[model samples]
Structures are given as structure tokens and as C-alpha cells.
Target: MHTTHHCKARQSQRGISLKMVNYVLTHGALENDKIVLGKKEAMQRLADLEREKRLLMKIADKGGVVVVADGEALITTYNCSHRN
Candidate 1:
């Protein structure tokens, strides 16, 4: 029973991590040195992306223009070319 519970916990943790990864991948953008988000707008955008599985790119375009960060979210500009 204990072993089963432990395995289940691990599975759940993994799922959570994957979801976070997906969220970041679908939202985060790299500019210059740091990976950051648009702060206020990112929360809503993240929700929309998670529900629909489609990113709303009104802020930043994906591919050569913008690159996603690895872990944790931060605040930054929408334009990849722009620097702080």
C-alpha cells in the first residue's frame, strides 16, 4: 500500500512538472540574456493556451523571433529584438 501510494505521488509530481513545462514552452520568450514574460498579460495568455493548446501570439511570435525559457517565469518585453 505504501509503495503504491509513493509511486502514485511520483506520477502526479511528474504530471505537474510536465504541465509547467508546457505552460512555459507555450508562453515564455527569450530576449537578450534572460527569459521573461509580459507580467500582467501572461497570466491570461497562459490560461488560454492551456485550455486551447494554441498560443495567442499577439505579444511575441514564436520560432527565430522568440525562444522559450527553461524554468520559472519572469517579466520582460514582447519583442525579442528589444533589450532592457
Candidate 2:
């Protein structure tokens, strides 16, 4: 007998870049396809959760929103229990 694994896919669309999806998920913004967003919404969605606010971007271009950490762009990926 062979065992098959049941994998749960995250994003509704496969075209959504893994980096982009992971970005939103990690920041406590998006919840399973919903995002409580923030500013720069004109081209992207973001949220200042501490400030209790959200901004929605009207554009649909999948531009890479650079997130800087410790004076550098955080470009990375690793093997975790989850991924996009």
C-alpha cells in the first residue's frame, strides 16, 4: 500500500508570488486571503496595527515592495512547516 499526503494550498491563485504572499502573512496583515492593510495602498496594501489603521492599494501590479531590516532589503526563504 502506498500513502498519499493531503496538502493544503494557501493562496487562491497560483500566480501570486510566494515572496509577496509570505510578506503579507508574516506582517499580520493578511488572513487566509483577507488583508487588514495599510498605506502605500495606492500601489500596495498595508496596515499599522498598533495605530488601528489600514490602507488599500487600488493598483494590481505585482511590484516588489522592498522591506528593509537592519539597513538592508530582507530577501530570503527557508524550510519551515509552511510556505506559499
Candidate achieving the largest TM-score: 1
- In lDDT terms, how accurate is model 2? 0.41
List candidate 1 segments past 4 Å from native: 1-16, 46-84
The TM-score of predicted model 2 comes to 0.23
Candidate 1 lDDT tens digits, 11-62: 6877745455455556678778644556666877868768665444534454
TM-score versus the correct structure, for each prediction: 0.26, 0.23
- In each prediction, how many residue pairs overlap at the backbone (N, C-alpha, C within less than 3 A)? 0, 7
Worst 10 residues of 2 by lDDT: 55-64
* Candidate 2 lDDT tens digits, 3-82: 22321143433564556545655654556767644446523432344233322231113232333455565665332333
Query: Cα deviation in Å at residue 6, candidate 2?
Result: 9.2
Model 1 clash pairs are none
- Candidate 2 Cα misplacement greater than 4 A, ranges: 1-14, 28-33, 36-84
